[model samples]
Target: MDNRFEVAVSAGTMRSDSSAAVRFPHRWTPGGVTVEADFTGAHLLHLAAAGCVLNDIYREAESLGIDVSGVRVTAAGGFDTTTWQSTGIDYSVEVSSDASADKLAHLLEVVDQVAEIPQAIRAGASVRRASSC
Candidate 1:
């Protein structure tokens, strides 16, 4: 079976200028709640990391037969204006479960090694801009 997946979101800027407003079609929470997308690029990047970790935790917990009641992951980072790159990307995960501390720690470590967004960032994926007039 093919386990690979591709996730996509569509966004655009109102203008080509430096002050152009970025817009997204919509935002959806894991609980199936939809909200307007009014966040910056930095905010979205952090969110992606957090979301990936949370999802992976659930997956791993399920495979380990661990019942997880709740999970929260917080990711924080900043972009250096001079270098135009991200820095200090850090995160914390809080999980509510009945599993032992050692099991939980092991699960977290495994997920951190395999989660997609953080891996991509760590690998320094090349980004290229395409424009049409």
Candidate 2:
């Protein structure tokens, strides 16, 4: 990892209904996927996670000199309305490459470290709202 490309993230808060856009110094590439989510509000968290992972994976693959011509990621997550919680998220990645199977497998392993959201969710991080009184 290049020290100059490194970034740190901190969480912030604003009143409900107030739009506080989170900014990243780096840009995320959509990789031409047509799938999109709409009108879900905070439910968009899952979509954000999926998109972030897919973007990170594609970026990492390119950095390693792998040609990604027709790559696709199918990510889906379910929220439990009863508990207002995420049930789980699943990611299916399709890469059109001539790389060996072992190399592709290694690429997937490297992507896990590059993408943070899915790992955090998988580790069961407690995401909750904390308001000051």
Q: Pick the candidate with the highest lDDT.
A: 1
Candidate 1 stretches greater than 4 Å from native: 1-38
How many residue pairs in model 1 have overlapping backbones?
0
Model 2 TM-score relative to the real fold: 0.61
lDDT of 1 by residue, 38-72 (tens): 37676677767766776687778878888776665
Provide C-alpha RMSD values for all models, in order: 11.9, 12.3
In candidate 1 the C-alpha lDDT for residue 18 amounts to 28
lDDT of each: 0.61, 0.54
> How far out, in Å, is residue 56 in model 2?
1.7
Worst 10 residues of 2 by lDDT: 1-10
The per-candidate count of clashes, in order, stands at: 0, 0
